[model samples]
Target: MDIFIKIIYAAISILVATLYGLILIGIVHKIYARVHRRIGPPVWQPILDIIQTHGRKVATSHGIMFFLGPVFRMAGGMGTYLFMPVIFGSVVFSNYSMAGDLLLVMYFIFFGQLGMALGAGEGGHPYSPLGIARGLSQMSTFELPFSLAVISIAIQYQTLNITTIVAAQQGGMLNWTLFTNPLAVIAAMISLLGMNMHSPFSLVLAPQEIPIGPPIEMNGSFLGILQTNRALFASAKLVLFMNLFFGGATNLPIMMLKTFSIYMFSVFIGAAFPRFRPEQSFRFFLRIPTLIGILSVIVIAYL
Candidate 1:
């Protein structure tokens, strides 16, 4: 009965997290529209879009791998969310956080990207591989700084447990890593801008040239699944950042506020800047953020 209850709780948390993610996307769209002085779609637009996409008939398939691309994407998103505690002390929202630590979370985060890359390769679209190549290149570059920053935090706290890290930040806002370890936070936030795939860093999905990039060949239900995964994945990333830097939330509303705010940091930058080429993006991540990440490690080691 205890095991069954845990499964039921996990399902609820995943469902809620997915829904919140969709709403967050809608809010992001609204913000973008406001920035451009144009009327945006309703805040519920993503939900409607997903419903319409799923309702469309898929007339074809590019073999088994193609079909499994969205599956892997969704699995990656769901798995990442499950491994992170949502509401700290809350019983229901904890999910499977105890089953893994920060290292597993990092691997789970990359799992979907690799899976999607494989699926995209199976599509036979020239642009698909091109986008995947650019994405992987950019990922490799950013991962250096991001990984270093994460390691620095782990070393400073002397643990790789997400819950433990958050607990250490309790007491007050100054306890947050964002205040104490500004260098690491800066490195992570810059890497996040690239990870979010927005303007300036959005070369991977260069719609003007690639017509939506990697998932270009996908349509109908498959497209819908990818969209759903996007929401979940984005939210999961925001939550991870919240836990690491801003201190984890103790309730749903605080979680939404912090996550949304962190997400907007990317959106605002993306809206203001022009897109960077793959090479340029890679170099940018390697230069400034990498330097900061290194300094963070040095500071943590000494102090």
Candidate 2:
């Protein structure tokens, strides 16, 4: 009975997180539209899109891997969110957090993309592999700084348990890692620009010579699943960042506000900055963000 309750609670948590992500992305489209001085689709546009795509008939299978690709991607998204504690003190939203779950969440972030790469490769789209190479290379480069920041937090907190880390930040805003260890926060925030796949870092999916790279051949339900995973993955990343840096929210509204604000940081920056070449994006992360991340770890661990 106790185990069943946990499953029910976790299911609710995931449902809330996934739906919240979908709505937030619709808001993002509106923001981007305003930034470009155009009226965008309604905030419900994303939901309508997913429904429309799913309503279509799936094409004949390309291969087993192709079918499994989006499945693995959705699994990866759920895997990242499953163990994360949502509202810190709320029993309903706490999810199933446990020791070392942070590491697992981090791994799942990459897992979906890797699975997509394998699946897309089987699609025989020539551009799929081309984009995957650039994307993987860029992901590896940006991940360095974010990984170092995670290490710094672990060293500072002396535990891989996310709940413990959030507990320590309780009581006041200054106790948050944002104030306590600005370097790691800085590094992580900059890396987020890449993680969100926004301007200067959107070579793989943005308006390039070959756009919508990996999913270029994906259509119908295949495309819908990928789109859905994007929302969940992006929200999970934002919520993780909020927990680690801004201090975990104790209520749903606070969580929503903080996550929305954090996401807007990347969105506004995307609007302001020009897109970087793939090589340029790779080089940028390897430089200053990497240095700040290293310095953060060194300061937290040794200083």
Candidate 3:
């Protein structure tokens, strides 16, 4: 009965996270409309887009693996949300806590990326080559400072459990992780900008450079699923980042607002800047964020 309860809880949590992500896509679409000075599609636009694309023709791949890729991506993302702490005193799947550290979570993120890369390769499209290369390169470049920033947070709190870290920030916003380690937050903020694939860091999918990057050849139903999942993943990332620094609030709307604020900032920056060359992105990631991460460690160590 205990195991069965856990299963049901996991399912409910995954559903909540996925739907929350979908709603966020709607929210972002509205934000984009405002930013671009045109009325964008409805908040439900992404969901509609995916539904319309369902069952349309697609480029066939090495059969089962190609079919499995998107499914796995969605599953992995859902799995990720399962482990993440949602509110004070609650995480859906407690067992995942045993292995859910900054390092483990990072690895899960990479695992999803690798799965997408392999699936793209199996599709045998010319653009897939470029997309995978660009994706991998971008991932490699930003990972250094991102890792360091996570390490700094772990050190400060003296624990790797994300739930504990967020719970510790109970008093007020100033006591939040962001104020406690500005440099680390800066590094994390920059890394998130890249990880979110926003403007200056959008070398991987620069329309002029690679045109949608890893998902270039994907189309129809498969592409639709991938697109929906992309938005879902993006929202989930924001939640994870917020939980890291802001602490989980009992109020859902407040949490949503905070997460969307960070997301909108990214989108605004994206609209304002041009894409970076891969090399330029790598350099920026390394030099500035690494400096911040290092400084954060120093501050945390003695202060």
Q: Which portions of model 2 show Cα errors greater than 4 Å?
A: 207-209
Which portions of model 1 miss their true places by more than 4 Å? 207-209
**Number of the top lDDT candidate:** 1
Cα lDDT of model 2 by residue, 1-303, tens digit: 978998899888888887899999899899989989999999989889999999998766789998888888898888888778888988777777863478988998889889989898888888888888988898899899999999999999988788888999999999999999999999999999999998778876873365667787778999899888888888889889988999999999999999999999999999888899999999999999999999999999898
Clashes of each: 0, 1, 0
Per-model TM values vs. the true structure: 0.97, 0.97, 0.90
Preferred candidate (lDDT higher): 1 or 2 = 1
Candidate 3 accuracy as lDDT: 0.75
> Candidate 3 lDDT, tens digit per residue, 134-221?
7887887787788888888888999888778877887888988888877888888888889888789877866445466667657787
Better of 1 and 3 by TM-score: 1
lDDT of each: 0.90, 0.88, 0.75
Candidates sorted by lDDT, best first: 1, 2, 3
Cα lDDT tens digits for candidate 1, 1-303: 998999999988888888998998898889889989989989999999999999999998799999998899889898888898888888898988888899998888889888999998899989898888888888888888989999999988999999999899988999999998999999999999988989988878765565677898999999899999999899889999999999999999999899989998999998899989889999999999999999999999898
